[model samples]
Target: MIAIPVETDNGTPMSTKLFGNAKFFALVEPKSKDYTIIPNEGCGNGIQTANYLLEQGASSALYGFLGDGPFHVMVRGGMNVYWLGKETMPLDQAIDTALSETLVHVTTENASLYLDPGTAAGACECGCSHD
Candidate 1:
């Protein structure tokens, strides 16, 4: 499995179409310390972002957190959430945190709104809150 770590300020994944400030670190197995960087768009639509990653060959995503809406977006795009986060950390460390920490369960009727990993409070900025 290939591991892709994207450092998002709001923890909101962005569409692959636009170019922005988020940091994307991708790791392919069997090669130690061989993570590659992909340019990111700050924010756009959550589902688009997941689809972009899927097209890039990622089967799963490790993120800080996701609300009901964006979570479903990822799922529909064929990506699974491995972990959650409160803020952006080092790509490698964030991956470790997700692997070591417990994650919250998110669900929604609308697939687009279900997997919204924007933030705890669904805010892209600092004041976001969640379970």
Candidate 2:
């Protein structure tokens, strides 16, 4: 199942931001084109949110943006992260894009939100600046 953060339970459209502080999550099954909207009881805690998604049988998450800590937690839990870009479209369209293999796969290296300042500056492996 793929989890998509949405503003409402009706699933008309996806949230503009990531799952952070979201009130609901739409757990979608691509094959059947069915989905369940669930409340996010984790509050704003990233780790807790990740655990919640796992408990709901989510194999992947589609979002507009995600922070570093949450991204790592989701990745460690064996969940694929996909970026929906800057467009805010209907939930069904997003699912279609994902199923058609046109969404951008998010990874540590390419996820600019998670990049450390030292790492981006070509600092040592220890993440310490020599300057």
- Using TM-score as the measure, which candidate wins? 2
Global Cα lDDT for candidate 2: 0.71
- lDDT for each residue of candidate 1 in 57-100, tens digit (9 for 90 to 100): 76556554444444455566665555443455555554454455
RMSD of model 2 against the true structure: 6.5
TM-score of 1: 0.53
Clashes counted in candidate 2 amount to 0
> Whole-model lDDT, candidate 1?
0.45
Instruction: In angstroms, give how far residue 83 of model 1 lies from its true place.
Output: 3.0
Name model 1 segments beyond 4 Å from true.
1-33, 98-131
- Model 1 RMSD vs true structure: 8.1
CA lDDT of every candidate? 0.45, 0.71
Candidate 2: residue pairs that collide: none
